[model samples]
Target: MDRALLNALFDEAVAKAQPELAVTRFLPAQPKGRTLVIGAGKASAQMAAALEKAWPGPIEGLVVTRYGYGQACERIEIVEAAHPVPDAAGLAAAKRIVDMVAGLSADDLVIALISGGGSSLLPAPADGLSFEDEQEINRQLLASGAPIGVMNLVRNQFSTIKGGRLAQAAYPAKVVTLVVSDVPGDDPALVASGPTLPLKGTRADARRFVELYRLDLPAAAIKLLASDENLAPQPDEAVFARNTSATIASAALSLEAAAALARQRGVESAILSDAIEGEAREVARVHAALAKEVAVRNRPFNKPVILLSGGETTVTLRGKGRGGRNGEFLLSLAIELDGVAGVTALAADTDGIDGSEDNAGAFVDGTSASRMRAAGIDPLAYLANNDAYTAFEAIGDLFVTGPTGTNVNDFRAILIR
Candidate 1:
C-alpha cells in the first residue's frame, strides 16, 4: 500500500477505537437512584460527555483530565490537571471526588470513567504525605526507567484513593467503572492504578520496587510509607465487595481494529502481540526483524501483510532526549530496517501525546534514513541523544494529532508488501 493510504487506514483505526464510541456500547441501564459521575484520565472529560448523552437520569460529579483535554458537560464538572506528574489541581480535585462519594448510600450509583493518565491526574496522597512528596516521587519514578506496572504499584501504595480506596470511600454505593486500559495485561487494578478495585500489591512490594529501581525518594515519603498511619487500603476490605469494573477499550482492541482496516484494504494482517513490553529500542529491533522476514521470505505471513501490535513500551532515558516511547521505537526501527525493501511502519501513542512531547509519534519507511541523510541529518546521533522527534520533524514525518479526546495506549503498524 502507498504512504497516503497507509496513513489514512491507521488514523481510521484509531478513531474507531475512541472511548466516546467504545464506552457507549458498554453503558448500563439508568440507575433507580441518583447518578454520580467520577473519573480521571486524559480522556475522562470526553468519557463524562459520553455518559451524559447516554444516561437517562440526573448526573452530577467531577472528572479530572490532563490540561487541554477538557470537554463541556452540564452536570458533570470537568477539571484539568497535570499528567505524567501530579500537581495541586489534581490533588485538590482528587480530594473533592473522594469527599463527594463519601456518605453516598447504596441506593446511589457511581460510574467511574478511567483511562491512561488517571494515575497522575488523581493525586490524593495518603495521610501524612503531601502532594509535593508525591510529585517528587513520581518524577523520580518516571526517570528511573521502570515499567508502567511497577510505577503504578508504587503509586497505589502512596495514594489514599487509589488501590480500591475510592470504592471504599463510596461505602455501600454501587460503583461501576468504565476503563480505557493503557497497560499491558489489561489488569483493571493497574489501569489508573486501580482506583476502584482492590489493590493486590503490599507495602513490602512497593518498597521492593523502589529498591530494585534505585528510585530516589524524599525522606518524608520514606517515613510515610513506613508509618502505619499512612498505609494504603487493604484488598480484603468490605467496601470492595459491591464494586465492579470493566475494560471498555484497550491497546489490543485498538490493534485488532487496525488489522481489520488493513484487511479490508485487501492487505493481510497479523497481530504480533497485544502485550508487547520491554526497552523501546530493543522492541524496535525485534519488530524490524519480523517485518523484514515477512517482506522478504513471507515465512510468518505472506507479502502485502500488515503486522499490528499494541502495549506500553518503556524508554530508558540515558541522554537528554526530546522524544517519547513511540518516537524512540520508530527511530530504532528505522536504523534496524536500513532501507529494507517494501516495508513501512508507524508507531504512535493513541492518546496523541507521547511522553511530554507535542507529537503523538512518528512514521518511517524504507527510505527514511536515506531521506534524512539527503537532508544533512544523522539518525543515529539523534537516536543516541533521544531526539527522534527532531529527526522525524526535519523529514516532515512526525505524527501530530493533538489530544484525540481518548486514549487506549500505543498503536504500532508495520506494512510489508
Candidate 2:
C-alpha cells in the first residue's frame, strides 16, 4: 500500500464535501422581501459565504461556528464560538439568532445554513435552564460516549432556538434550511439539533438518556425537560407549512468520491457503510478483521482493494488522557493488526478537527505497532488511557489539516494489498 496514495484519497474525500463546492447549488430561490440567513455549525461560516456569493439580493443574518472555523462573509455576520462544549459566546450568539428572526412578515424569508457541530455552536438554554447548565450537559454528553443523534435529542430539549423553534419563531414567513449532514442516516433533525426543522424526539427521551449516562442535572434543567411548553413544536403545527430543508452535502457523497479515486488508481474499492456507529475502538476492531480477511483469504475481494466508511463514532472516556475518536480507532486497529503486512489505514474527521483535538486524525500501517513498541509506547496502555493522540504524535503519524470548512462525519479508509 502506498502511503502517499492513501493520503491523496483522504484529501479528495475532504475536498469534495467542502461548503464552497456543495452549498451554492442547493440554495433556495430569492424571496421578494427581506432575507435573513441564520445558522450554526462548523461549516456554517463557509456555507454563509457561499450563500452570499450566490444570492444577488441584499441579505442580512448571523451564524455561529466553532472558534477558528470562521470564514469571511460580506453580508452575513459570522460569529466564532466554542464547540463539543457550549460556552458563553455560543449562548449569546444563539440568543441573538433567535431575536434576529422575531417579527418577520409573511413575505420575509429565513435561510438556515445548518451543519454538524451546530448543537454545541448554538446553546440557548430554555427559560429555566442557565447557560452553565447547558454547558455541563454538553460536557457530560460528549464524555458519555453517546452518539451524535442521542446527544442532539438531549440538547434540543433545553435549547430556546433548536428543535424547530427557529422555524416556529419565523412563522408566517418562508424558512428554508440548507444542511451538510454529519450524523448517521443523514437525519436533518440531528444536524445541528434541527434548529429550523421539527423535533423528532421527545423530552422523555432526553430524561431517559440523562439516566442512561448517569448525568446529574440542575433542578431547573430537569423542570424544563418535563414542561410541555418547552418541548419542540409538533410537526402538524401550521408553522411547518412554510418550513423545508435540503441536504447540500453528506458522508455518502464524500465516501463515494474517495471510492471513485481508488478505482481510478487501478484499485477495487468498496464502501462498507456510510452510517456505521459504535464505540471507536470497537469499530476499528471490525475494520481490522475485514482487512485481515481481504489480505489473508481474499474472500471479500481480491488483493489491492480499499474499503471506505464514514460515520460518527463515540468514545466513553475512562481516563484523563487527551484524544479523539479518530485517533483512538487507528491506535486500536494498529494493535489488532500487529504488523500484518499489506494493510494500511487512515481515519479522520472531515471537518479537520477530531473531537477537540488539533489533528483531523491519524494514519496506521502494518508497521505502526512495531514502531510504537520500539519507541517505548504501549498500544494497550495508551488505548486504555484514551491517549491515542500522544501515541500517534510520537510516531509522527498525526494527520492535521487546519480547518476544512466542511463537515460530513468521520472518514475511514483501509487498503489491503
lDDT scores for all predictions? 0.85, 0.89
- Candidate 1 residue-wise lDDT at 85: 91
Off by over 4 Å in 2: none
lDDT of 2 by residue, 1-417 (tens): 377778888889888888888877887778888999999999999999998998888899999999999999888999999888888898889889888889999889999999999998888888878788988888888888888878888888888788899899888889999999999989887898898997677778888998888877788877877678587886778888867889989999999989999989998899999998999999999999999999999978888899999998899998888789999899999999996998888999999998788999999999998899889899999999999998999899999988999999999999898
Q: lDDT by residue for model 1 over 1-417, one digit each (tens)?
A: 466656776587677767778888887766777889999998889889988988777889999999999999999999999988988899899999999998888888999999889999998877677778899888888888788889888887778888888888887899999998888889878888888876677788888988999888888788866765556677677777777788888877777777777777888888888788888889999999988888788878888888888888888788886989999999999988887988888888888999998999888998898888888879899888988888888899998889888787888888887
Root-mean-square deviation of every model: 1.6, 1.2
TM-scores, all models, native as reference: 0.96, 0.98
Q: What lDDT score is found at residue 340 in candidate 1?
A: 93
Worst 10 residues of 2 by lDDT: 225-234
Candidate 1 error regions (>4 Å): none
For model 2, the local distance difference test gives 0.89
